[model samples]
Target chain A: MSKLTIVANIKAKADKVDLVKAELLKLIEVTRAETGCISYDLHQDNANPAHFMFYENWQSRELWQIHMNNQHLADYVAATEGAVVEFTLNEMTIID
Target chain B: MSKLTIVANIKAKADKVDLVKAELLKLIEVTRAETGCISYDLHQDNANPAHFMFYENWQSRELWQIHMNNQHLADYVAATEGAVVEFTLNEMTIID
Candidate 1:
């Protein structure tokens, strides 16, 4: 399977930062358990408390696609309906 | 030193892909040798041949600032000239 490295950039609403963070953290455990998930790490911007990102590794695009449509992901999106202001997904491949 | 994770998203001009790749790769060795560099991983997009990104871990924002002024980085920027289209820098912190 070809590897896929991703940087998911997220910005939580100013007033809902903590709630959004709690909801985002739940995705980590559930995402790591999915097939082809090699690494799923979450990060926040030190200077910007409301900004967040996820550095992820997947065995293949196929597996990642499935995980994207997983129920947990849907639940997360639903839970954070107005909690996020900006959400961007960046899919990458190692240069080595 | 406080940790700082960064995702540098880059896009190379269509004609300068190989040259840009070469220049970008040179940063790996040099950046890793810097005082606070813990990890400096380069990656490209699977679907976008011209797109690239760097996943970096620095010991502190101060060290990273010094790195920004490093000669190698300056040289790379100069060497590439107009080879880049869009460059976005994202600073992050581990959520753990």
Candidate 2:
């Protein structure tokens, strides 16, 4: 299990749903192009559209850390600063 | 945006790590051949090897529910009953 995976659950403010969604979707394309990126996806709760989750796989924890500090991610975070109401992050590794 | 995704976090009892892992990996091959399964991946925690997470994608929620009631899944559940210590599940839709 060498992959560094990330599962991040996030909630957006009611009024900022569209804005938050656009930014999250942008992460998929941008992050996937970054070095060491294996997989990057975004999911939303069907019952609660404002609730979202990020599913990502990186080559290593160190690379993931670099992704966390990347300018694109930082920009997304900055763009959605207060729009996100709540978030929970989980860092994991592949079990296969 | 139509995909039904599953994020299940599970923890195996300290002594049952190997047993739980075998069963979890078995799911990948078995589930992938099922009707609507798109992607099925298994992951563990770097700090806690016993901790596992399932990242799955299905064509539809109905198909995913059918998978939940499938015999293979039922058997896996039965096989690892006591080995799993804690679990949390989240059902979501792809945010495209």
Number of the top TM-score candidate:
1
Q: What overall lDDT, based on C-alpha atoms, would model 1 receive against the true structure? A: 0.90
User: How well does each candidate superpose onto the true structure, as a TM-score?
Assistant: 0.90, 0.85
For each candidate, what's the DockQ?
A: 0.67, 0.62
lDDT of 1 by residue, B1-96 (tens): 779888888899999989999999998998899999999999988778899899998999999999999999999999999999999897888885
Candidate 2 off by > 4 Å: none
Give per-residue CA lDDT, model 1, range A1-96, as digits (tens). Answer: 778888788999999999899998999888999999999999988778999889999999899999999999999999999999999887888985
TM-score, chain B, model 2, is: 0.93
**B4-83 per-residue lDDT for model 2 (tens digits):** 88988889999999999999898888889999999888988767888899998899888899999988888999999889
Candidate 2, which CAPRI tier?
A: medium
Which pairs of residues collide in model 1? Answer: none
